[model samples]
Target: MGPLIPQEIISLDWNLVIAFVVGIGFGFVLEASGFSSSRKLAGIFYGYDTVVLKVFFTAAITAMLGLLYLSLFGWIDLNLVYVNPTYLWSAIIGGIIMGLGFIIGGFCPGTSVCAAAIGKIDAMVFIIGIIIGIFIFGEGFPIWKEFHEAGNLGSLKIQDIIGISGGLFTFLIIIFAMILFKTGEWAESQFTREEY
Candidate 1:
């Protein structure tokens, strides 16, 4: 009834087709959201623009609510979903490194692809940097293997850890996002500029 791939009700070809369609939708949305511009993307960090944060948090909350309700109605099997295994310290370390990359390069792996598609030179460089980072990770995988496999907290949901009602948690996250959205809107006004 859920996770068409894991359950094997759908063929691999169907999966690929779905993936392609989803990728196109994703790309279209990113471009329409102005994510193709590195300056627009970078503004989230500098307080000049915060479309990035607003879109990110809004998407997160939307998905969070959808999953919560889907599970509640037994429309989806939450356990069948992919859960990123926690690697303890590596999450913090990797997140910090990614944050630095985003701040400096102004793109993550996905958005960088869109930016490069739209003829952004800096995004092209960022894509190259990501490739290099992946190459480095592959070469050094042996060294990081221990940390990568460490603290194996298997497939967990937020409710599993916090012992709260899923609906309550989703509501709280939405409230938090509303606060951030307000702040982001304020910063956009306060930090508006008349010159490039």
Candidate 2:
């Protein structure tokens, strides 16, 4: 009864419009929250400011809870939802590369694009680097295709993997997030920096 796009309740064109609007809103929020600053992003790694961790945890938990509630209420069909297939080795390699990029460049792809939009020279350079990296990846896909396709685990959910209900897994995630939030607060106090 939900997932308007897949259900054809909303046309493809309108879905794209909605996506654009959401993207704009998200970018505005990020910029307003000082995510446009590379220093602010890098602060997470240095234990100076953990706003990134807090915000991310909040968003993830909120989304998970919201989806769970929606499905329970029959507003969304959880079975109709798509899950990305797990490619273990590629996923790990990709995450490691992305983590290194975030640590060194001080911005993930999304924040880098938002910062670049606001005329940040460093972010602009980072975006260019991203483009170059993507191009290289595209060109070398054949060479790494086998490795990328390795460890093919079909679409699996955390709840299924752990043999728990979605509700229980989400509740546990909330608890974990709470712990991280407390740790982040402590880290912020310990690594306060006046510059950024």
Candidate 3:
């Protein structure tokens, strides 16, 4: 009825197996969708290709709405769902670092893995960097542990905080997406090159 593991409908082994299956599906989709190319991804910023924007925003808003609907239907209790706990300063600083990494490295952990699977040398290097970064984080967790634990707005709901119904909020999101989609289409026509 809810998240299977939390509801005890699925055992941990079943949960892990499902996660692996989902990951495989996700990776296959991304690779097939051309997300495996860093150039293809960075095009979101430049506007030559809107595949990244289209896919990302579509996935995000769809999931957002789906969760809202699930909560409304009493299928998934919103209160029981895990929200990413906030670490305010860490979020800001980490976001900046992550943005820089995205700009320079051109692949995030997911996309890098996707590209790596499809045999891209750059993506393979990016995955190696991610592994090294993970190792460093494990080694240095004590140093930033305090900051990471700082701003715990535990499982906060944006809808509750903003005092707006999720339906209305989703409407606003759809409007914004329509505008962005139009602009992206315009830019793609304007900026597309023969080379790419």
Candidate 4:
């Protein structure tokens, strides 16, 4: 809601309320999708289950298509949508750490919270680790401030970066997703786990 208040449709006051409602809805969806199970959420890395990939890929495609269609129909203004500025070094390092944490702990931050809400011990421990990490980062912010701010590339869209239209980019992504889906299916069959 920080940047969204400037947009046409939603106002400042309702932003927090909308965010709270959407967050709850998102958590419910995650729980319903079996993301509350650490094994299920971690299965993507082991190749036994591909539900995580399928769900996330579907979500990305749906959101992209929804926004594109909404813009076309004048239901939403794409120009008004906020894009976060890229801090390349920070992003690369953060992604690596996050990925490692996800693989080792069997829960990403959001999924950990979702699982913890439903009384998962592992997820609770993971959340505690996350809090510790956050505290460390906050306390050591000054020391790593330069590295965190390094490689500023401004806000970028994939379509803009690749010199293609947004629609064409989305189409290519959809095709890639189809291929990935098939690959995920293959992986699941090849790496079937009895526990999963």
Candidate 5:
């Protein structure tokens, strides 16, 4: 009954409009929460600030719980949700590259875009680099197509891989998030700094 777009309850044009509105809202929230500051975003790694971790974990857990409730109430069909197919090697390589980029640039692609929107020169440069990287990746895709497709794991859910029910997996994730949040609080206290 829900998943309005896929179910045709909402028209395609309306879906696009909704998506744009949501994106703007999300960006506003991110900027308002200081995600526009590379220093603030990087603080997660330095242990000086744990706001990033807290916000990320809170959002993730909230979404998971919301989806669970939605499914339970028959407002959405979990089975209708799309999951990306796993390309093991490419995923690992991409993740490593992304991690390095995060450490060095102090901003992920999303935050960089948000910062760029607000006139951050560094973020603008980062975005240019991202566009170039995308171009290179697209150009080289054909050359590495085999390796990219090597790990042909079809769309698989974490619960399936871990041999647990979705509900149980979500519960465990929530618990893990809570533990990490507590740890983050401790880290922030220990690493508190006079500036940033």
Candidate 6:
């Protein structure tokens, strides 16, 4: 009954339109939340400002709970939802590279774009670096193709892997997030930054 496009409730023609609208909405929210500021975004790593962690954690939990409820009520077909196939080696290497980039540049791809849109010079430079990185990766794809495709674990969810019900997994995640939130609050108090 859901996964609108997969169910044919929404036609393919509207996919890009929906995505564009959602992207704009997301960018607007990021800006409003002060995520456009590199300092604010980077504070998550420094343990000063936890708004980034709090906002993202809330979003994850909200989405998880929303999907759970929707599936429970038969409003959505959970099976129709897409799960990205896992590429183990590529994921690990990419995560490390991106983590370093985030720490150094103070912006992930999304936040960089959001800040760039608002005329941030640093974000603009970050976007240029991102483009250069992409160009290099594309041009050298043949060299890393084998490594990228080496660890092909098919789409797997935590609940399926751990032999638990989705609801139980969601509950666990909620508890974990609550603990993180408290930790983040404490960290902010301990690591208070005069500039931020």
Whole-model lDDT per candidate: 0.87, 0.94, 0.84, 0.91, 0.90, 0.94
Name the runs in model 5 displaced over 4 angstroms. Answer: none
Looking at candidate 1, the ten consecutive residues that score lowest on lDDT are 151-160
Candidate 1 residues 1-196, lDDT tens each? 7677887888767988999999999999999988888788888888989889999898999899888788888878977888887777788898999999988988888899999998988899998899999999999999999987887777667776899977888898899999999999999899995642
TM-score winner between 1 and 6, please give it: 6
Q: Rank the candidates by lDDT, best first.
A: 6, 2, 4, 5, 1, 3
| Model 4 lDDT tens row, 69-169 | 88777777787788899999999999999999999999999999999999999999999999999999999999999999999999889899879998989
Pick by lDDT: 4 or 6, better one: 6
Q: In terms of lDDT, which candidate is stronger, 2 or 3?
A: 2
lDDT of 5 at 16: 76
Q: Taking the candidates one at a time, how many backbone clashes does each contain?
A: 0, 0, 0, 0, 0, 0
Model 3 residue 192 lDDT score: 96
Off by over 4 Å in 1: none
> Where's the lowest-lDDT run of ten residues in candidate 2?
4-13
Compose the digit string of candidate 5's lDDT tens values, residues 94-186.
899998999899899999999999999999999999999999989999998998898879898889988998789999999999999899889
RMSD of each: 1.7, 0.9, 1.7, 2.2, 1.2, 0.8
Candidate 3 C-alpha lDDT tens digits along 15-122: 778989999999999988878889888887788888888888999899989988888888987666667876677889889888777768888789998888878899
What are the runs in model 2 whose C-alpha is more than 4 Å off? none
In terms of TM-score, how similar is model 6 to the real structure? Answer: 0.98
TM-score winner between candidates 2 and 3:
2
Task: Evaluate model 3: give its lDDT.
Answer: 0.84
Per-prediction TM-score, please? Answer: 0.92, 0.98, 0.90, 0.95, 0.95, 0.98
Residue pair clashes in candidate 4: none
Q: How accurate is candidate 2 locally (lDDT)?
A: 0.94
> Residue 157 in model 5: shift from native, Å?
0.9
